[model samples]
Target: MAYPWKSWDRALFSQVAGRHWPGAEPVLPRLSRAADHGRLWGAVAAGMAVVGGPEARRAALRGAGSLALASLTVNTVGKGAFRRARPLLEAVPVIRRLRRQPVTSSFPSGHSASAAAFATGAALESAGWGALLAPVAASVAFSRVYTGVHYPSDVLVGCALGVGAAFAVRAVLPPAPGVPRPGPAVPVPELPGGRGLHVVVNAASGPPPLLSPPAARIAAALPLAEVSECTEDDDLAEQLEKAASLAAGQRGALGVCGGDGTVRLAAAVALRHGLPLAVFPGGTRNHFAADLGLRGVEDTAAAVLERRGARVDVAGTTALDGGARGAAEPFLNTFSIGSYPDLVRVRERWSRRVGAWPASVLAAVHVLRTCRPVDIEINGRPRSVWLLFAGNCRYSSVGLAPVRRRDLADGRLDVRIVDGGPYARTRLLGAALTGVLTRSPVYEAAEVRRLRVRVPGEGVHLACDGEVAPAPRELLLDKVPDGLVVYRGRR
Candidate 1:
């Protein structure tokens, strides 16, 4: 006699066999076959990559990767670990049974694992795509049992493994911008059609290829608003200051069109002038704007005209030593020291020639080869580190370099450090490559309201929102809650 759970599994399988799921007979068998060797998920990933935008491409890549991991695990470890035979098909209807039955162990369904992994991975990247793929994944899983290729328990356990595989993949590279919950709403002047809005567009700012030129888009989106273009020769800070002054004088709002670095400067100017900001994502990798729910000029323009705004935390670094004593700089996104700044510098040098993605790979290689550890005291603890990163708010995911932020006004610093030691770089790289960096001894992360960093000798080169600068030996990093107001509609 089999165990009680095994008996229950057979009973459930028999019940499903007896049920008449209208319109499922033809679909279930064919769907099961379609998912053979993860083919169905591969086709979906290819389609997403071809027709979808950046986010879609990311989803597709992550889905395919997760599917691959799930299939590998199922074949290499899962099947060998349990040699359970395929379910007998005598009770299953002939029409519902697969024409060619699977020959491998049936303790866990490989098809079910692939389906769950792909759906979960894609959804982790983009909920909309995940929602569309979820039903299909479920159907594929159920079809395995309906077609008599796997037991109900087999499919269930396989699905659990698949979802775990998806999360494992996310632990490696992570996903895109998180859901934009733009803090608390704040009152601002309504600038319909850009009226009473002063926008300074960075002429050098370049968005993705799909978008039109930043200047043209800003002009078209905010027609009635005052616009100033900052050329390469023009001092960006001066131009931003001038725009903020104009907007303040007119009791309007200040706007900026640029990347994270440019947005940091604009945020500082806006905060100082007591004015609201309109952020147009007109640069490559607009981290700040994307987190603020402004994906493009149109989004910011609509928010401005509709008088929708929110207040977000602003982080600042105050100099405690050197000539810039007491001087302060504010950053809206991220600040880091050590290998990250080196990586940024190297990437910028080669980005124009090889493109952004390849440039990043090259930068990582270059920095890994040439960069050295820095000695610093983190909150009075002396340590040698390869990197130290602090974000304005707590980022959602964890890894060597986490990207998304769920809350902009959390008023906490998301700090991470990579400890330096013998074979430290190699160990760090291996952990990152294997998707287990979060648990690696070399990596450390924490959330704090403030941090005091002191360098051993001369200050290390630090980067704030991708802009590298020489730092003072001693510095204080703290957040100012609800420090900056920006246009962010609830949409």
Candidate 2:
């Protein structure tokens, strides 16, 4: 007999299909987001402080415990009671990323629910990670919807469920932690603790001489560091990668002697291997070294050997070749996507014999006479221009070197875009002589985590730091907080 409610039951069942995982799990994205939102938790805690009175504060102590328990109940208890199929029953790309088939009703996204509940709960207790939870939760939900894995309404309900769980627990439990027990705020870092040692020196990273007499100037201070010369031109990066791998693999700290680009490469390898990286600024500019208060190679070396340095955040670019523009890999340092990269390559190639001045003078004249404007878009808004530079660290040229301010550790990339013009061209040339480039209405300034430069044509030359790559419009510069540890000193 054909049941009148057959279609209705099928629709309902589809909404609650597969969404559960059994047995041991390493870590869920929702759970990780809940625990590690870091700074985002700050704002959430601030907002929470208002409504919950003294009694409320005391009750909120078990925030993490409650979040975990509530999540357990929602999936284990509530899910079975209302089994429904997921939106992915229809097939979609986004849902394919999910860990398992959601068995319970898909009305509420479990990932979204768990993420929201945990985020709010953690914010109520811990000072870090709470703030970013909401956005992370939202993204998870959006991905579900975008991929046709779940309905928008399900995500909404899931969010509400998480919020409700947080408040319920907050109203009942006692204050967990981070209430700032009356008195001055004690700095965790200043407290007594041991620090790890680190050193970096990329022997093969080009431009920075790792085997010359001056190289001794860097090695003298870090006599204890593992040293290798660029005998076969493996490049500074390959050298540091080896050194960093050895140190990290050994579970020991490291020290280095090299330029900013070398430092960045070593640091990346170190970070990947769970080791710290130190810098000697072996290359010209040494932009990051200056920003980290390294002063110069000699002093920087002394500090690493002496144990006066501390950890500082790092900034980097991924794919800048010795040519200009973008390519398959990323680069470290400022990227030039117009005439600027070519100018650097022209200078770098010639500096082999004549030194920087002659190369600079030649590139300056070439750019001043030629070089046309190129189109650009800042923060998704389209605009046209010629010269563009994105800097991981701020630096202005001082004679033979570039100088950066000390104590500026904000994790943001600095950017400059100059329109292709004769007067502007003149300024670009002057900057090559002097590494300072400022942005204003005449010159555009942008600070961002991710951005893309689209060239109407193909194969634009990309110059990074001092190296160059060719790909035209495709370029991505990433900011790595605590990217590299530079040796700091009293000076």
Candidate 3:
């Protein structure tokens, strides 16, 4: 499913593009026909009231403001930096716009840019509120077109500018006052933290929150939350060493705001220091975060500073030093072999542009067509398998289709066979469409304390916590049962 594109009817693009190209008569009106934005903006204001707490509300407002500011800045400042011209104003159908002409230069569509910025910023903080605010944002943008003011291309550029501006604003400011934060498990307190948030911002460990307004929202919300930027070049071990130094001397929990990769990095530091680690959903899929009921990470500072967090079990995978000389290592996510590894390789190449899920789909299709199946024994049961997944928690989603069952805290890891015939393929695809995870005929609930899989391949490539490592033919999977101490909500 090449969504948002592949699924999009190609004809629609042809129709839209047709209007912009050729000696097409101007379907949109001239600049003199612009409409009033006040009425539509009032609707946007009404929608903001529906947000959860003071922090959330503030974030929504700030996001919108940032979005608007970005639009204005680009149209006035950034565009001036480039001195670009509007398509039609130059006497030719320059760009596509359903709206009329703007009094100023039109390198960026302020309406489209601000609308996208507001929608993205708001959604990052509260998905529920974000969804409501979206249509209003759309109407604001659509106004530019309906009034014959801006073109489609102008809005596209504006969208980029707006999103950038929101992120830039969020990076400089703290979360809005009175906004409530989400905990992995616990409810937040009324008062903000007096000491500030001891934030561990790992840039390399995961995606950059500074660019992702949603992730930025969560990080900015922490109280008096002092942010410690963790750069990839800097010694992660050293940075955490410093975090532990501070946490060890202070009172309260250790807050980690990043993806699964970041969590593992920070959690490792927190685990060694004997401090309770709090988790924020900053990763792409965030299977673990979703399983625990944490959503809308637009802002998480308040929750962390308040010491309102939950605890969960961490998964471990032992890796040996070449020649099996050392102890095993622990991992938080899934471990797999064969096709999965190859898929990761391909994803590493494309994930930067399309995103994680899209990369995963590309990987899935690649594996389905190429990689040969594998035969292995899991939990002492031998079977011919195409893929063997050992998950610490549930890693299943049905996309747009209905799911079979979802039990995150069943207190067991899941094992499954990833490939099969067309019937099995249909079942798995159906599950993703509906957010309803299901078991495949090739899949089994192999939630055991210890599992042994004798790999048939010469060198078994394994991934634990999305980290690839070496494994011999005989691979053992075991659960520590509340193994590592992590600060999040329910396990």
Candidate 4:
């Protein structure tokens, strides 16, 4: 049962164990133990999530996912397939050995695999983070041999497996593309220290919390900028309108710090007044800001000071009956109806009390239990649907939910519909869970320049950019190409 590589692996393990290095007794063993069961990497991921921007958050999530995949594969398949024995510790230094040794097969090192997977996954999303984590990962891999627990070949194979797992995770959930090229750069005033910039701050926005209040950060970064705070008692749209008017008179840029809803309102006003917009992401899940590559207040401030700007498309809804409520109203992110509007309603109702993530979970459960289909006309064809989603641009998704968009100014609507039928909900959920929702008969996804939707009954509520409003029975959803000009740093 002696393998040809066994002698070489043994000899290498002896060499590593027999060597004496400076400062090796106290640190390496403790580091190895700290990495047991993926604790070290988990702590690193948490730190990145708390302190880093959108890219950092994405890197942390991707790294954690990849680690999980690698660990699962190593334990369930790799180890069982090759039940190699652990290396003999006769030539090992007692001080460097782990207090509690691993009991699994030693053909592939689980710790090494997890480290490689996390580092590779994070690097794939963000090179800067990857560069930082690579050394830690390498150290952990080398520790396996230094502790006299695994052969070098085992560590190498484990790293290879880990890398493969990270790539597999990427294939399932691809990272968003890098900063898009500036779209037809528009001329804008370079405001130093945010002079001539008027910004309205929504004090009630944001989730997961920031290190400091956005207003304070903006004030510190751009001292000369005129900042106004809007509270619950204040009317948001009205305040934005007033700020836009003021900025217009001063020949300055209008700025908004809030969620997608607040940004959407500011955009409408900026477009009306022919003023460029600056967006500071101060909201829960700053989807629009992240897509625009504005990671924080500093990014938008830099863009404004440097006069870096571009034009992006905006989508809106108009009532065929000429109702004021839906007359040429613009939305920056998504518009949806049916069960989804109900979800948004429920989420908003409880978000203030329980927070956004918990509220979403509660709303999802509530919708799944009590929500029903709505009768509507799609392009003059009668249909019953559980949900209808229209995105400003074509979105990427693995299932029924629209995740993110690859292009902002695609000049098209990404429309997805869930047809109502017998066991429609069950079928839809099953398909989504199985990653076959796109192929399911009840699900339909397409991209178009315009969409016409009609409600057969009384007024239906429409949700745009997380804001819910009443809509006329007959409605048209279409894109306004190159509609809003906003500051975005060039890549």
Candidate 5:
């Protein structure tokens, strides 16, 4: 009972099975057996959890989800749609016959589908880890044909189905930036009539106050809440500190309306006073506020009154020399060294003419053309690095737009280093433009609990949460777990 395509399928299967040399014979069987019933996927997940960072673990989970989908498709639709029988054992060596032959139709190999789906899904999240797993996936798929259980066509079609399933999942739930997922929401005692709320508005920080009018909007939303406004002449840090002190003395929640830098300062003060912090998105990008699901002052006020919120991690840096006085400086977003500060300065200069996003593009071009790598010592090892970025929490380096962390409580820093050597500038620029910076050999990413960096001399410009500061030659960076509680709506 040979089907119309049976001859061609068997010919291909015979070629694959017949070419098995002594070198691969033993290893192929072991690999095939290990991958049985999706065990290989579980192994991959465990390995990633052990060796990979938070993002790697997430990617592995996503891969598992895709594998599940692909398995469902192959077993249900693919098997029933084409009821092809398994390859004849006569053409296969006796030792190569799979001990446990699949009972379902052989038009598609379910094992191959799962393997491809897992690999493709993982690659989409983090290319470095994906590349590491590609060879294993290939071996698993080839084993199906080599074992004489599935025809070559079956394995090929199954692989396609797996890849398709991975893409489908990505479309439905795209990879998130910052924290890939938000932290769990916890209910706080409601603030009756905004009794325990105090807000500070930075008039000079973000866009012109006239367009957004943060103070007026916040007052309208929470009339009972006290608001402090920072004028052009006032020191924003001094004003923020005063507001934080007032809130702390009154045992109230501290709210700050400003850019990421302003929010970061407020967060530090709030942490010191052990008061919950509310963010109003007054910045150009509002990266921190957006990550908290706060769209505007109105949403922030509502969340505060309702007493719904989550605790998030904060990143802090200290001078390695132990010379700088006071507590470690806190940053709510990213901190970078090397050419990044120069790029930011250029972007700011051009932003007035072309706007923020457009200016960034032009600024990158200018910086790449003129910038040179800086020599620094990371963990006592000398290396020339173009840029070193440390994110408060894990961030996705993939995709066109910048990615944030999904879980703020993961308590790990996402550190990325762009290798600086021969043609380093060109390679870095190409990687950034192509959105393959994480995948490029010239770039390296890791999830670390702490990082120590030392420069040869003093007066190094460091960028923290979009604000530049002249820092000393040595620096120590780490995350402060549960550093601040932020208002967030329940999911």
Candidate 6:
């Protein structure tokens, strides 16, 4: 069948080349040559990593991924289907012709495809980065025609394909978060001898300290406060709800003497009833408590009595796979997928035998040795990741210990992703042992208000606030600005 568009395509090519200026003749060829084998795009990605901030690094990585997809599609499918021949050599100037031309069909220009893909993908992540790259992408696309390798129609089609591929890739990745608005700061109410206070203690959470008859100690400290204990068979959510109800009726604050998961529950209840929450460092790790600089139950209790506290943002997740039972769960510290769940499982299994710190190290080694990257879609782009973590706020490295969030009210989620590249086990082990996992090349971090994680298969393991849960096929994570009012002793 004769295609009518072919004639018009060739005519357009002829007109573009006929109007080409002499000044561009010297520059276009160099740009075209630089893009050979997609080396220029790789260089751009590397440069962004070295010089750009967190957002820039993320954009660079996404751009590289999109470029790869565009190049593959153009070379394998678009070129093969059209089988169009390159422009005639006699139609171009001798000086403008490439020394070694591409030996593939020329219906769609590969260079143009890659350029458009990178620019479009980067822009979708960060408009500033995209704006910076747009001119460069356009120049590279024009270079193909200026160098007399690809015709105008070929470059045009290739660019269109590239842009389409970028959007298609982004569709699979998690969507970017919205702008955060500062939440209203709620004042902390004083608790004289815990007169209007309610506390729930989960016996099964963390070490013996959290479980060490918390009701007795709490009663001794706050004689007038109501205290509830969750037995092994008791539903934690129910216990928390009951405590919240009591606090609402008594006009008091709700407190949790347990781990991160318990703290998360208390935060949710506090938010729902507009009550302040007191977090006791009763968990083995007590990530949230540590972030708040709370040493133990006594310090938390003292903070409550003094009415000293801060309103902080909370991280919330909605399971897309019907697993959450139609409710968004709040997390106070960090939420993770991939190898992290494995590590936590291993740690729990061996902590009794070898202590918490040693068990953690062993768990790291064990998980790293057997861990494989998870196949996930972020926003809408497919990615294979060894670990993906989102902290409630920005976490800065503090020596050999775990990361600590410096600001709880920043209203952003600190997302860190570790790419599962070749020999991932060895790389991860080395980074962990060297205490440089957070700074490794395989690691990428960004601050976002919202992110979506989707798994191709069912039963994605997720670790939220040190507790494991089976997440549905998709999960939407977002930051709730000043979502919880918590008591913290003045520093």
Candidate 4 lDDT by residue in tens digits, 1-491: 35689878888888888888788778778888888999999999999999997789999999999999999999999999888889888888788878788888998999999999999999999999999999999999998999989999999999999999999898678888866543577898778889889999999787645487888889888999999999989999899999888888889999999999989988889989999999999998888888888988888888888888898999998888745445588998899988888898999999989988899999999999998888899999998999889999878655455757777788989999999999999999888666677899999988899999888777578798988887678889999988888999557
lDDT of 1 by residue, 120-213 (tens): 9999999999999999999999999888888899999999999999998987767875456777898999787788888898888763446567
Residues 1-491 of candidate 2: C-alpha lDDT, one tens digit per residue: 23354465456434433334332122333333333322223334455556654333432334444556556766776666665566544534332334454455765566556656766776666544455455665655555554344566666766777777776675444233221111111111110111333344455444644355445665455554455555445565666666666666656555555565455456566666665445666665565555555556676556555555454444544433334644233344566677677677777778778776687888767765776766655445665566677665443321112223323345656666666555665665466434354432346665676666555565667665566666534445566654444345454
What digit string (tens of lDDT, one per residue) describes model 6 on residues 179-203? Answer: 2222344577667899778888888
Model 1 misplaced stretches (Cα beyond 4 Å): 1-29, 45-62, 79-108, 122-132, 142-157, 170-185, 231-234, 323-326, 357-371, 379-381, 395-401, 421-450, 457-459
For each candidate, what is the lDDT?
0.88, 0.53, 0.55, 0.88, 0.82, 0.80
lDDT of 3 by residue, 20-104 (tens): 4433234233221221343344345455556456445665677666766776687678667544344333323444444434576
| Residue 37 alpha-carbon offset, candidate 5, angstroms | 53
Candidate that would win on TM-score: 4
Q: After superposition, how far is residue 258 of candidate 2 from its true place, in Å?
A: 3.1
lDDT score, candidate 2, position 151? 63
* Candidate with the larger TM-score of 2 and 5: 5
How much RMSD separates candidate 5 from the native structure? 14.2
Candidate 4, pairs of clashing residues: none
Please give, for residues 380-455, the per-residue lDDT of candidate 5 as tens digits. Answer: 8998888888888877544222446677778898888887899877776687655566678878888899998888
Estimate the TM-score for candidate 2.
Answer: 0.49
**Cα lDDT for residue 71, candidate 4:** 98
Please give the range of 10 consecutive residues that has the lowest summed lDDT in model 6.
Answer: 174-183
**Candidate 1 residue-wise lDDT at 305:** 75
